[model samples]
Target chain A: MRNLTEEELRVVFEKLAKFIGKDIKALVEDSNENYCFRLQKDRVYYAREVVAAAATNIARHNLASLGICVGKFTHGGRFQVHITFVTYLARLAKYKVWLKPQSEMSFLYGNNVLKGGVARMTENTPKNQQVVVFNQSEIPLGFGVSARSSLEVQQASSTDLIVLNQADVGSYLRDEDHFVGCGL
Target chain B: MDGVEVDLGSLSCADVRPIFQEETKQELEERIRRSVEFLVHGLFTLPEQSSERKSQRELPEPFSVIPRAKPIPKEKPLTKWEQFAKIRGIRKRKRDKFAWDEGRAEFRPIHGYRSINDGSNQVILPHDPSLEPGESPFDLLKEGKRKRIASNRKNQERNKRSLSKNQLPTHALRADKRSSKSLERSAKIVSISNRSLGKHEEGKKSKQKLSSTKRSLKKSIIPNGVERERTFQAVNDVLKNF
Candidate 1:
């Protein structure tokens, strides 16, 4: 894929900075044949992704931050961008939401990781339907997009990265609250 | 109805009639007499010898009181060991106080030096080598080493005290002996009061911090599309807008 235009790169970094609170140090076109953007900051690879360049122009705009991986090397390409992004999205969707008050909500997390928070499509789309939206702002802050084919029992197989369906989502919440066997 | 007279053969009528009348009267009297005699004999005659029954009925006599012998009391047997142990335990308890004081002192001396020396010396040195008739050269050498160590420790402790002359006696010695006797009781009251004050202060601080945080979280919204910094950025954005 051709390199991202200077203007396009700037706009993407701006969106990223607004969401992440950190400026993009560098942006480079990835060596992979698929069109992916490699975001560099302070000489460290922070995030890299396949820009979904074709999807960007199609107007089916859902900016999906699939997953995050700590860089194993200084050079950006050590990890695959699209796979990592998908993993990150699945991880975010796996976060369970506690129905308790915020004071008790602290139990859902360790080291300030937001563990219990519910995420649903803006329009409550049916199971297996794809949700696309422009920019991350359209999506809830604590919630993220699902890249897999179907979210099953709140569990997406590693091979099949589906968004977790609603019943499974409720089941996860019930299990997390230690009320699994309460016939939820 | 005719007055024709019937006469016996060759008998006159008057004589035959009178004689017939008298004989008839006599015959009737004899029959009546015989019936009377049969009735009187039945009345006088009773039961025959075979019909009579033998007498066997009897009645009980008055009752009398009888005395019984008094029962004897039996002795409860005692085991030899139980009696001996009871007597031994009483005597041992009386003797134990002094032994326990000596044992505890040997077991745990307050000064580390003494405790270590006491333990090591007991293992290495003879209990009372002098009791043996022959005195070994090693025994004298060991005794000399122990004496030197004891003197050196005593001198070092004195030097340490002199160096820290300005330091107050530890809290332990400052309390009077009588007060120290009830140290745990007084310490309990002091600790309880301190803990209560500490808990109250902590509660107040947490409540104040929570209210301020809740207000801030409610007002803030992350400015950009980034997910990571939203919480902190939102707070900052709210503060900036406010």
Candidate 2:
């Protein structure tokens, strides 16, 4: 990873602020030293780390400074996602559409949500907007974009597309062509 | 009066004889005819109806008036099967009754009354479980059944049907009241213990709530704030980097 100048960092943060609906620079600290780069790294960054260096100042108190932690890496970090406890808790992630229980397994395997499978959705869930898909029990299945408006999805007769399957946690266990990381 | 009839063979009409004050020839003929008819009736029915004749003879009149006879209702005998059904408390249909005895192939009484549906042969569903006392019955929907819980009244109604008519409701109620008093006395001891147990449970519930809240707070939010001041300092120190 290469460090970024203040100009490029400002631009990235500007786009991120719109997506997150908040000023994220105020939420970060400069002394944070964890890696926060995308695949092609270019950045000074802050990241959530479950572990801390023991020689650091106030290292003993770092464990109690945050909320509950669960394993984010599995098989010695060879995989970035674990098999269990994958929950979507991002406050910024908004739009959602739920599928019936019978359609959940196929949906997690990167299949498009078939007709009559939509359980419910937020009113005016606009087309082409990023939406998180959940199961009947509200467990986050993946992130997708609305292929149809919320009204059309509920009222359409033909088996038209409703959501475009993007990334899912189930894709990690079973290799699929469209397997991206958990969008949450 | 004994009518005299002098009838010798070859008597001429010109030789008319009158016994009573100058009777006409026509009157003499009627007298003679009446005399003959009386004699013939006496000969034919005189002995055959001798008992009646004797009684009538005591009466001065010639004939007597007879009284009219009344017709009696015909009685039918019950078959052996009908007797057995009656012995088992089954009876013929009456007004408002709807039960049918399939074994006997006939409509039977419902609630101990005869049925009035004389022409209906349609099958009826068992309404014993579905109906309450004195409630009118109608066709129920095939779905959405409501099941009634068994209760003392239901049991008492069953017992009342099995009981003889001599057993009155007041006697049963008095007996039940006495038994209930005894049961309540016995239950008081157990209820005292249960009341104390409920208090103990409440005490434990409050203690559990306190522990659960503390654990939830520890897992959800920051339990230590050592980096809070330093993190804010670094955010404020962002301008120094320029």
Candidate 3:
């Protein structure tokens, strides 16, 4: 694992801020332990400083994964957050959407959440904002880009798309091969 | 007259007298007059050419009598290749300026403009067995030619640098002065503030200078909370503009 370059760091931070907003500071400056981001084979890992340092002893090709895999930088240099990053984002997400029980399975099946599927959403959530998706019991399922803001969602037709699904917990099984060294 | 001898080539006459002979000033002047008269008579008797205007006596070619004004210059020092050639007893042979090119079926200049081997005119290059699978011969040839041009340019730059180091210290100092420290610092700041921090800029020489300035500005592992605070501020700045 290596330290992210200034350019890569800015991209990662900006993408993270889109979902968590100002809480990126809390993510970096955790009170209990020091956490830092390390990059290995284009995948950015969030790990304790000691763990990141110790993992350096392993050869690059042999080492599959280290700490929690947050995201991977695409070949085009865009940062793409993975489904595994849901835990952290769910905790600090500024806006959230809760899916009704009947439509949760459809969302897990990689389909966009329609207006009728959304049980509730954070008030005043802006349009096209990144938001975490949760069930009625507050169990984080996935994350998506909001197609309509809270105000617009009230007026939107039932069949109209409310949230555009980006990544979901169902990817754990569907994309199992991709997450081989992603520390599960 | 019997003791005098004359060299027509030098226009000079030498008179020989006995060592014990004493002569008065009038006798000396009379002897010189007789010698001069004899010389002029001999000149008139030799030959004559008549032109429309006048008749003139033809004179024989004169022997050079005067010494040269300056000494002969020393030969220049031999170059390395010349010295080597001399040691090996190699004699240079002149080659013809033009060579027959079989492909063109005509004689062409061996070097310079429109040379036979310039490759620019080739529409189809022979396929090479060593080329990788799926690789186009045309693209490979182009890449190789580009690499050769780049290397040639690099070698030329190296030669120029060596030449400047050996012969143009004042010129090199003037170049340094032209890119003064304050000017360079301002340029660096401008480059850093430009879109993409001037990372996509073209100039190879100035790129090195810009990177050095960037390295100096980069913070080296600041204390944990301080860096977090700095990142927080940067995030705020981005969010404020967002």
Name the DockQ score for candidate 1.
Answer: 0.01
lDDT over C-alpha atoms for residue B28 of model 1: 61
Fraction of native contacts (fnat) of each candidate:
0.00, 0.06, 0.03
lDDT of 3 by residue, A1-184 (tens): 5667666777888999999987877887655988877788899998887787678667778889888999999999999999998999999999999999999999998999999999999999999999999999999999999999999999999999999999999989888999998977
TM-scores of all candidate predictions against the true structure: 0.18, 0.29, 0.49
Ranking by TM-score: 3, 2, 1
Q: Which stretches of candidate 1 lie over 4 Å from their true place?
A: A1-184, B1-132, B167-242
Candidate number with greatest DockQ: 3
* Quality class of the docking in candidate 1, CAPRI style: incorrect
Q: Write one digit per residue (lDDT tens) for candidate 2, span B1-242.
A: 35333222222112234477778889878866766665444444433435745533221233323355866654433444565787998877655546776666887765323433322333664466657776534333222122222344454443433332222333244333344334333333333345553345443232222112223322322312333443334333443342
For model 3, the docking class works out as incorrect
Return whichever of 2 and 3 wins on TM-score: 3
Could you give the candidate ranking by lDDT, starting with the highest? 3, 2, 1
lDDT of 2 at B30: 84
Worst ten in a row by lDDT for model 3 chain A: A1-10
